[model samples]
Target: MKQPNILFIMTDQLRWDCLGYAGHPDVKTPYLDTLASRGVVFERAYSACPSCIAARAALHTGMEQAHHGRVGYEDNIPWKYAHTLAGELSAAGYYTQCVGKMHVHPLRNYLGFHNVELHDGYLHSARYSDIPYQESQFVADDYFYWLKQELGTAADVTETGLDCNSYLSRPWIREERFHPTNWVTDRSIDFLRRRDPGRPFFLMASYLRPHPPFDAPSHYFDMYRSMTLRPPFVGDWESTEELKRYGRIFDSRTGPADPELIRQAQIGYYACITHLDHQIGRLIMALIEHKLYDNTVILFTSDHGEELCDHHMFRKSRPYEGSCHIPLFLCAGKEALETFCPSSSCRGLIELRDIMPTLLEIAGADIPDSVDGTSFLPLVYNPQGTPRTWLHGEHSYAEHSNHWIVTQTDKYIWYTQTGKEQYFRLDEDPHELCDEIHNPVYQERICLLRNHLIDCLKNRPEGFVEKGRLSAGKSYPPTLSNA
Candidate 1:
């Protein structure tokens, strides 16, 4: 068999339930839904960390956040950790390229890639601000530079609002118009058409949408109105005292309940997702139009899910399903897809870290034994294969939460600050409305999973195996503090 090209599509801040195929009947993600039907969509896929910096690092290095120590988006980038998939693949001779967003430091600076088509992050050059004549900006510097370059005078604009709605309005959209979500299709199509025919290329086109500033064209906005949408399946998580303790109004860990406003925000979010769905359709059709759909592998998923007003809350931070359960799908050569999911079922527990190894295994590239995740190739082949049931996800943020180990039947949540432990019988309570954590009857299961979390925390692998390249703030200066 010949080596096939790889196309990894990653969306930012996408909620797992926003896609039509992901059980959201009202949402229209036609392209993604079609991919799920033809490919392998992990119905129960999740992210290791809910924050962008942490989760992206885990996905890139195949390590948990604890290992990478990238606890949050606002946190500094610990540069000396592990060699990323990009670094490994580019060195292995693939014409690796990434567009849109690479939150990691030193964009296009080869954290590992031949060259990036879009330098979309932030920039802090001395020439621009007259700050200083330094050689560079922050490693993962400016996220808006590409938009600035593409839109010229139009880029010097800002629309402020706590809601994604104002951001989605014409001003922000046109301002960030070179937004990878809008222009990524153009760059991806160009790569597929212009790359040397001999080398198998690996292109990762990351889209920033369905994230926030949830405004979209009237066409998509027309598809959803504040009045027509459904509130979270479980909005008042405070119904029970056990759940009540975890409830918060907002993320700086403050705010009051404003139900109507949250509802409107959600409507905007749905609009953003629906808009992204249309863009994805264009990108996928381009794959088919350029005649690369058959030979190339297309994988679609998100970095992390946004927590939109679940439990009177409006962001990601907890181990609730809304924050951790991300969507993951793979569509490619029939043989390879069959080899991974011969059973043809879109149900299984998958982690973000597995993406790297799965891509490597499918391309017949060598996966380093040192990497933390196991390739889901076998599970894909036998979707029901003696299911590999255990996946480890971690978090270290404002509260110093330890780790979470979600298995086939139960989820054990451990927090570092209070040494808090809780276990939920997920199969019976998909929404996790009940906290059986302290229930005496389920104490046995709780204890068992609690042990797993402890193992993950105590014996967990120290992260960013780059001997410091990926962990310590060495090779790379800190990440975007401007955020």
Candidate 2:
């Protein structure tokens, strides 16, 4: 096939199992489920840093968080990479355009995209007096600006009184057409109409919904309002005290004050997911109408997963499945995956860094050596093929700073600041309800995984490890701190 157009769809804070194809019993994601049926699913995909900036850093640069120089989730840091997925694709004659959420520094830096219709939704760091909403720094924010334009200056998330990170459930403040999700889908379809027909295009439709504010349109919210959503998974070893202690606050690590509020939050979250799914269906229809569907490779994934009151956690940046695991699937029109094996699944450990190289390989472009990720294209035909034996990931979050090593069937985790260890047999316990670190029966397995973690951090500039073993009490930087 000639160079195919790439439609890369990404979402913020979306759980891996939130789709119908991923065993989500409550949320309705028919469009995504159809796409998954026509493509390949990476069952073990993960976000290395599991935060906005650092996750995107690994995504754009095709490098691990540590190699990308943002092991944590620091913002305002310039994306000064010598090589980027969009940049390389553009260099190889593909026209790259991002319609939403670049989440990079300087707010408008394209990195490699020829044009970016920016809409990074409700960034607390950029919404305050330090970077006033109307300042030039925030002027190009398409979503925020458009919201005020349609609903007047008084229009803000505060109008609904929904905190950006809170689990509170509510319909959008205005009409569904004015929502950010619709805006992104509308602009993406517009791009399909306006893009240069002579060039194969790489379009990124990044949605910020399903992240927080739990503000889905009324129709979407109503879909789940009457249904019983799946309760969050809580392990025997987990504690809800953290959430109870820090409840009734916005963006707090711990969530709503009680079980009732927590349920309300889940209702909102499920509504957002379904709302986003409908918008994606619109985008798919647009592609079909334009006759671009068959020749395009549609890659659907997310930056990271949301905790959503799971194990008493609300947001991301943890090493748990709800925080680190993400959905990854690719689809193409008109039996395009025949050569790549249609309706397949791979159990390899995939990460955000692998996305760039995978798309590059799909586009028939040369993969750069500077990329720490290896393309998994071979796995399309051979399901057992894997790029690596295991994936090593870490994140910084005050006392929660932690590192983890995971393969297809098992995982080993360590809290960098506390030197605490955890082991889980994913094959036996997919929800991670049991921590087997203290189990004497798995001592040998623990040793192997511990060594893997040690080797992963042995060369770190942060001295996380010395003489091939981690030492406790290291001061890891916070996500938003300048690295």
lDDT of 2 at 72: 79
Candidate 2 lDDT over residue span 157-193, tens digit each = 6678777677777888778898889999999999999
* lDDT of every model, 2 decimals: 0.64, 0.86
Global local distance difference test of model 2: 0.86
Residue 99 in candidate 1 has what lDDT?
73
lDDT of 1: 0.64
**What does candidate 1's lDDT look like per residue over 159-254, in tens digits?**
333343122233134423444456776777677788877888889988767665565655565666635666665632244342345433332231
Model 2 error, position 353 (Å): 0.4
Q: Each candidate: how many clashes?
A: 30, 1
